[model samples]
Target: MGASRIKWHVVVFLAPAVLVYTAIMIFPLFNTLRLALYSEADQVRAFVGLENFRRLFGDPNWSGAFWNALGNNFWFFFIHMLVQNPIGIALAAILSHPRLRFAAFYRSAIFIPTILSFVIVGFAWKLILSPIWGIAPDMLDAIGLKSLFAPWLGKEEYALTTLALISVWQFVGIPMMLIYAALLSIPEEILEAAEVEGLTGMAAFWKIKLPLILPSIGIISILTFVGNFNAFDLIYAAQGALAGPNFATDILGTFMYRTFFGFQLQLGDPHMGSAIATAMFAIILLGVCVYLFAIQTRIRRYQF
Candidate 1:
């Protein structure tokens, strides 16, 4: 009777959260997958199976845009991995220094941008980088580096890179805070032992702290991967549905948006959009699975 009562208690406790997740996440995900299997024609919806997928991959008209967006998404994710994560780790290391002063102030200042609205960050940076009547050029001129100032957001070569950097500036704090907490959780006894062994300063960080925080770093990396691939709002807010300068800033999210909702003269095709979304889901799922099954396993083995 007691065991049965305990089982009921467990169910009661878990039921609400499970229901909420099913309704919001599971249902929508499966529904999107279902939608991808059907196509609308002549005001009639019919089963298309993998036909949409073939069109997306094999049809030149769609394939070109699809590949371009996928490539840009990779670059965006790469920039976050290359620049943002490293900067975040470095900042976390600096801020976690035992003797550091004004640590809270610095942390709060850096993290404040993370909480800001994406629309605000995108538009504000757009205006700041505007070639005319913008502060970026004026600031450069004031510093006697006027010749170096160019309209970064207006150039196809630079627009994606510029937005990537802006995204880095906003979200770097997340990794920093996470890593900082991980650093703080290191047992004092371990540090004392390290100090006794003369593993101080950079030596201590490299040899001692780094290995201990590897799990945290791994978590942060996967989180960044998921977040970057799902990214849309900032690009849309900054560059519009077009994701211009000549679609250079186009990522999967914006591409999916344009396909799903239609823009300007383009007709909306929910079937194609669902296919794109499914592709995104598959990509993200693959990445996460790789991390969990391969990278995470390696990390655990190393720690052990």
Candidate 2:
């Protein structure tokens, strides 16, 4: 009787959260998936099955945009992986040092941008980088490097890379904090043993600390993947829905938005939009599965 009452209590506690999640997340997700399978003609919806997918993959007009956005998305993810994660790991290592002064202040200062709205970060960066009225050129000129100043966001070759770097600046604190916590959690006894073995300073970190924090690093990497794939707002705010400089900064999110909601002269096609969204979902799922099944397994093996 007591166990039955406890079970009832658990159910009662969980019911509201489960209901809310279903309403907000599960329902919309399944609805989008369903919408992707149908098409509208003369205000009448019809079951088109895989026709939308075929159109997305086979139609040159649709496929070109899709592939462009996808390739840019990959490049964006690559930049975060290449630049952001290493810098984050390095910052975490430096900040986690016992002798470091004002560590709390430094952590807070670095992390403040992460809490700022994407719109604010995007617009602020755009203004700072603007050649006509921006401070970036002035700052470079002050440092005797004015000749290197180009309108980075205005050029197709530099726009996506510039935006990727901006994103890295905004979110690098996350990986830093995660890695910092992981570093702090390492037992003192292990450090003492490592010190006895002459693993001090950089040697200690590379040999002793990094190995134990591999799991945290793996988690941060996967989080970066998911976050980068879902990225839209920053690009949208920075470059508008068109993702211009000839769509150089266009990613899956902006593409989906443009297709789903219609921008300027383009007519909204929810079915095709949902198809694009479904492709994004598939890509994210595949990346996550690979991480969970392959990379995570390897990390576990390395740890054991």
What overall lDDT goes with each candidate model?
0.92, 0.93
Worst 10 residues of 2 by lDDT: 295-304
lDDT of 1 at 65: 90
**RMSD for each of the candidates:** 2.2, 2.1
Candidate 2 Cα lDDT to native: 0.93
Model 1 Cα lDDT, one tens digit per residue, 1-304: 6644567767899999999999999999999988999999998999999999999999998998999999999999899989987888899999998889999999999999899988999999999898777699889989999999889999999999999999999999999999999888888889889999989989999999898889888898899889988899999999999999889999999999999999999999999999999999999999999999988888753322
TM-scores across all candidates? 0.93, 0.95
Worst 10 residues of 1 by lDDT: 295-304
Candidate 2's TM-score reads: 0.95
Predicted structure 1: lDDT: 0.92
Model 1 residue runs over 4 Å out of place are 2-15, 301-304
